[model samples]
Target: MTSGKKTEKYKLILDAAVKVFAAHGFHKAQVSKIAKEAGVADGTIYLYFKNKEDILICLFKEKLGELVEKFHLSIEQTTNAKDALRRVCEIHYGELEAQVDLAFVTQIELRQSSLELRKEIGKAVKPYIVLIEQLLLQGMEEKLFRQDLDVKLVRQLLFGGLDEVVTSWLIAGRKYSLSAQIEGTINFYLNGIKA
Candidate 1:
C-alpha cells in the first residue's frame, strides 16, 4: 500500500483502539476487538503499533500533544492572566466534550495501564501542566491571584479540580454540560483560593 494509505490505516486503528480501550479498559481490551472495530485484520494493529500498550502511548502523545499545542497558541492571544486562565479552562473542557470517547479513554481507561505506562503518560502530560503553572505564576505576579500561593500547588488544584469535574461528568454518562459549568467553577476557584 502507499504511504498515504498506511497513515490513514494507522489513524483508523488508533481511533478504533480508543473506543475499544474506553469500553473495555486496557487490561481487558484485546487486539482482536480493536482490529474488528477498525475493520482490519488482527495483524494490522501489530503493523501500526508494537502492542496494546504502544497504542495507548501513541494515543496519548497524539491527543495530548495537540491539546498542549492548542493551549499554547490560545493563551498567546489573551493579555490578561485571568482571561488566559478562563480560556484554558474553556479549551480543555471543550476539547473533552467534543471528543467524549477519547476523553473516556484518556480519563478512565488510560489509568488502568501499568505503572510504567502511567509514567510514560505523565511525561506526555508535563508540557500541559507546565503551561498551567506558568499561567498561575503570571497571575500571581500580576496580583490577579494570591501572591503567596504556591504556584505548583495552585496549578495542581486547578488542573485537578477540572479533571475531577470532567471525570465525574463522564462517569455520570454526561448528563450535564461540562462546558456550561466553566464560569462558575473558574469563579469559585479564583475567588475562594485567590487573596
Candidate 2:
C-alpha cells in the first residue's frame, strides 16, 4: 500500500479503537470489535498495530500529541499566565466534554490497562505535563505566582486537580456540564499558586 493509504488506515483503526475501548473497557474490548467499527477486516487491524495494547498506545500517542498542540496554540496569544492557564483548562475540559467517547477512553478505560501499558501512555502525556509546568513557570516569572513555589510539585497538583474534575464528571455519568467547571477549577488552583 502507498504511504498515504497506510496512514489513513492506521488513523481509522485508532479512531475505531477509541470507540470500542470506551464502550467496552480495555480488557473486555476485542480487536474484532474495533475492526468492525472501522469497517475493515479483523486482520486489517493487525496491519497497523500488533494487538489491542498497541492500538491503545498508538491512540494515546496520536490523540495526546494533537491535544498538546491545541493547548499550545490556545495560549500562544495570551499575555498573562492566568489567562493561559484558564485557556488550558477551557480547551482540556471542552475537548473532553465534546468527545465523550474519547473522554471515556482517556479518563477511564486507559486506567484499566496494565502497568506497562499505562507507563507507555504516561510517556505520551509528558508533553502536556511540560505545558502545564511552562504555564506555572510563566506565572512565577511574571510575578503572578509565588516565587517560592516548587514548580514541579505545583505542576503535578494543578494537573492532578484538573484531571480529577473530569474523572469525577465521567464517573458521575456526566449529568452536569464538564466544561462549566473550568472557571471554578482554575480559580481553586490559582488560589494556591498565585502570588
Candidate 3:
C-alpha cells in the first residue's frame, strides 16, 4: 500500500479502537473487535499495533497530540493570559463534549490498563501540563496571577481540576452538558490562582 493509504488505515484503526474501548472498556476490548469496527482483517491491526495495549497508547498519543496543538493555536489568538486560560478551558471541555466516546476511553477505560500503559499514556499528558505551566507563567508575568505561586503545583491543580470535572461528568452518565461547566471551572481555578 502507498504511504497515504497506510496512514489512513492507521487512523481508521485508532478511531475504531476508541469506540471499541469506550464501549467495552480496555480489559474487555479485543483486537478482533477493533479490527471489525475498522473493517479491517485481524492481522491488519498487528501491522499498526503490537497489541490492544499498544492501540490504547497510540490512540491517546494521537488524540492528545491533537489537543495540545489545538491549545497552542488557541492560546496564540488570545491577547491576555486570562483569555488564554479561558480558551484552554473552552477547548478542553468542548472537544471532549463533542467526542464523548473518546472521553469515555480517555477518562474511564484508560485507567484500567496496566501501570506501564498508564505511564506511556502520561507521556502524552506531559505536554498539556507544560502548556498549563506556560499559561500560569504568562499569568504571573502579566500580574494576573499570584507571584508566589508554584507553577508546577498550580499546573497539576489546574489540570487535575479540569480532569476531575470530565471524570465526574463521565461518571454521572453525562446527564449534564460538559461545556456548561467551562465558565464555573475557569472561575474556580482563576479565583484560586489570581493575584
TM-score of 1: 0.91
Ranking by TM-score: 3, 2, 1
Task: Point out where model 1 deviates above 4 Å.
Answer: 1-3, 193-195
Instruction: Report the C-alpha lDDT of model 1 over 68-167, residue by residue, as the tens digit.
Output: 8888889899997888888889998999999998899889976677899999888888888998898888887887888788888888888888889899
Which 10 residues in a row give candidate 1 its minimum summed lDDT? 186-195
Residue 79 miss distance in model 3 (angstroms): 0.5
Model 2 scores a C-alpha lDDT of 0.91
Alpha-carbon error at 26 in model 3, in Å?
Answer: 0.5
- Model 3 residue-pair collision total: 0
Candidate 3 TM-score to native: 0.98
- C-alpha local distance difference test of each model: 0.88, 0.91, 0.93
- For model 3, residues 1-195, the per-residue Cα lDDT tens digits are 999999999999999999998888889898999999999999999999998888998999999999999999998999989999999999999999999999999898877778999999999899999999999999999999999998898899999999989999999999999999999999999998899
**Would you list the rank order by lDDT, best first?**
3, 2, 1
lDDT top scorer: 3
Give the higher-TM-score candidate: 1 or 2.
Answer: 2
Native-structure RMSD, model 1: 1.8
